[model samples]
Target: MWRDLLPIGRHRGSGGYRRFAWTAADTDCRAWFKAQAEARGLSFELDRNGNQWAWLGDPLAGDAVVTGSHLDSVPDGGAFDGPLGVVSSFAALDELRRRGAEFARPLAITNFGDEEGARFGLACVGSRLAAGQLTVDKAHELRDADGVSLPEAMERAGQDPGTIGPDPERLARIGAFVELHVEQGRALDLSGDPVGIASAIWPHGRWRFDFHGEANHAGTTSLEDRRDPMLSYAATVLAARQQARLAGALATFGKIAVEPNGVNAIPSLVRGWLDSRAADQGTLDTVIAGIEAAAHEHADRDGIDLSITRESFTPVVEFQHALRDELAKLLGGAIPVLGTGAGHDAGILSASAPTAMLFVRNPTGISHSPAEYAAEDDCVAGVVALADVLEGLACR
Candidate 1:
C-alpha cells in the first residue's frame, strides 16, 4: 500500500507531496483509496461532505467503530503526516483479520477530504462541515489563491457541492473514532516509546496581517522618504517570535503575499499569515495580543496602515477520557499520554463523537516538510498498536 501511494503526488525537485484538495493529485489519491476498499471487500461510501469510507459490516448499524485519517498534504508536505494513519488503518484491518477477530460492532475506515486545507486555507474542512462547525453559506464563500471557489473546485472534480453540509445522523452512528498519525513532534522519541496516546490538542489559530503603504521604485526611493509595508512586516515577524517565546507559545509567518512583487519595487501591501498555538487558551490569547500590539506599533511608526483578520481558530480539545484511558489500558498501560500543539481531524470530530489519537514516534520531530519521517519499526509498532485498539474496541 505504501509503495503504491509513494509516487502519487511527489514533486521531483522538492521530493515532497503536493496533494492539494480537488486537484488531479487528490483525485489519484481518492481513486487509490477506493481501490483499496474494493480490494478488501469493504463497502465503500462517499459522504455528503466528500469524505470517503470503507465499511467491513452493516452500513446502517449503530455504534460503529471507525478509524483512519486524511490523505491530503500541505504545500511540499512530508509523506507521513496524513497518509501514515490511512495506510496504518488498512494494515491494522489486515492484522485483525489474520487474528480472526470476531467483531461485535460494525467497523469503518475513512479518508476525510481537504484535511490539510492547502487550497482553501481552512484545515479539516471536510470534518468541520460534517460537524456543523462550518456553515454551508460560509463554505460556499471559500476561495483559493487562484480565485477558484470551493464549490467550483468540487464541481471540477466531479463531486456534488450542493450536498455539502452537516450530517448529524452520520456522526451519531459513530460510537468511537480513533486516528493514528505519525507524531508531529518528538514526544514518543524522547520517551523511548514507539507509540503514544494523545491527551489534548492545544488551542491554535491562523491570522492574516495586512500592512498597507505607498509603493515606489526601490532604487529611487530614499530610506527616509519611502513608506514601505515590508519594513513593518519584517518588524512584526520579529515581534511575533519574541512574544511567542516570552509566552511559551508557537508562532510562525509561514505564508505571505506582496503587491507588486518585484525586486525593483517597494511593496504597496504585505499580507502575511500567522499560525499560532499554545498549551491553553489564555496563553494563546496573550501571545496573539502582544504580537498584534507590536504589529500596530511598527505599522504606525512606518506610516503604514495595518489590518488583521482571523482566518480560523480551534479551541483546545481534550480527548474523551473514557476512550483515551481505554486505549491506554488496551495498550497495556505502558504507552505514554501526551498533549500536542498541532491540530487534527480527531480534534474537530471530538465534539460530535468520542474521538482519540495515537502518535507514532518521529525521530527528528520534523513535520510538514520533506525531512519528516518515522522509522520502519516504529511504523510497524503503530500498526500493531492500532490493531490492538480496534480489537479491544470492536471485537467480541
Candidate 2:
C-alpha cells in the first residue's frame, strides 16, 4: 500500500507531496482509497462533504468503531503527515483479520477531505462541515488562491456540493473514532516510545494582516517620501516573533501576498497570514493581542492602513478521557500521554463523537516539509498498536 501511494503526488524538484484538495493528485489519492476499500471487500462510501469511508459489517449499524485519517497534503508537504494514518488503518485491519479477531461492532476507515486546508485556508473542512462547526453559507463562500470556489471545486471533482452540510445522523452512528498519525513533534521520540496517546490540542488560529499604502517606483522614490506597506508588514512579522517568544507560544507568517508584485516597484498592499498557537486559550489570546497591537503601531507610524481578519480559529480540544484511557490501557499502561500544538481531524470530530489519537514516533520531529519522516520500525509499531487498539475496542 505504501509503495503504491509513494509516487502519487510527489514532486520531482522538491521531493514532497502536492496532493491539494480536489486537484488531480487528490483525485489519484481518492481513487487509490476506493481501490483499497474494494480490494478489501469493505463497503465503500462517499459522504456529503466528500469524505471517503470503507465499512465492514452493516452500514446502518449503530455504535460503529471508525478509524482512519485524511490523505491530502499541505504545499510541498511530507509523505507521512496525513498518509501515514490512512496506510496504517488499512494495515491494521489486515493485521486484525490475520489474528482472527471477531468484531462486536461495525468498523469503518475514513479519509476526510481538505484536511490540510492548503487550498482553501480552512483546516478540517470535511469534518467541520459534518460536525456543523462550519455553516453551509460560509462554506459556499470559501475560495482558493486562483479564485475557485469550494463548491465549484467539489463539482469539478464529481461531488455534489448541494449536499454539503451537517450530517448529524452519520456522526451519531459512530460510537468511537480513533485516528493514528505520525507525531508532528518529538514527544514519542524523546520518551523512547514508538506510540503515544494524544491528550489535547492547543488553541490555534490563522489571522490575515493587510497593510495598505502608496505604490511608487522603488528606484525613484525617496525613502522618507515613500509610504511602503512592506515596511509595516516586515515590522509586524518581527513583532509577531517577539511576542510569541515572550509568551512562550508559536507564531508564524508562513504565507503572504503583495499587490503589484515587482522587484522595481513598492507594493501598495502587503497581506501576511499569521498562524499562532498556545497550550491554552488565555495564552493564545494574549499572544495574538500583543501581535495585533504591534502591527497597528507599525502601520500607524508608517501611515499604512491596516486591517486584520481572522481566517480560522480552533479552541483547545481535550480528547475524551474515557477513550484516551482505553487506548492507553490497550497499548499497555507504560505508554506516554502527551499534548500537541498541532490540530487534527480527530480534534474536529471530538465535538460530535468520542475521538482519540495515537501518534507514531518521528525521529526528527519535523513535519509539513520534505524532511518529515518516521522510521520503518516505528511505522510498523504504529500499525500494530492501532491493530491492538481496534481489537480491544471493536473485537471485544
Among these predictions, the greatest lDDT belongs to 1
lDDT of 2 by residue, 15-87 (tens): 9999999999999999999999999999999999999999998979989999999999999999999899999
lDDT by residue for model 1 (322-350), tens? 99999999999988999999989999999
Q: At residue 212, what lDDT does model 1 achieve?
A: 99
Instruction: Give the range of the ten consecutive residues with the poorest summed lDDT in model 1.
Output: 182-191
Q: Residue 62: error of model 1 in Å?
A: 1.2
Where model 2 places Cα greater than 4 Å from the true spot, the runs are none
The TM-scores, one per candidate, come to 0.99, 0.99
Superposed by TM-score, candidate 2 places the C-alpha of residue 366 at a distance from the truth, in angstroms, of 0.5
Cα RMSD to the true fold for all candidates:
0.7, 0.6
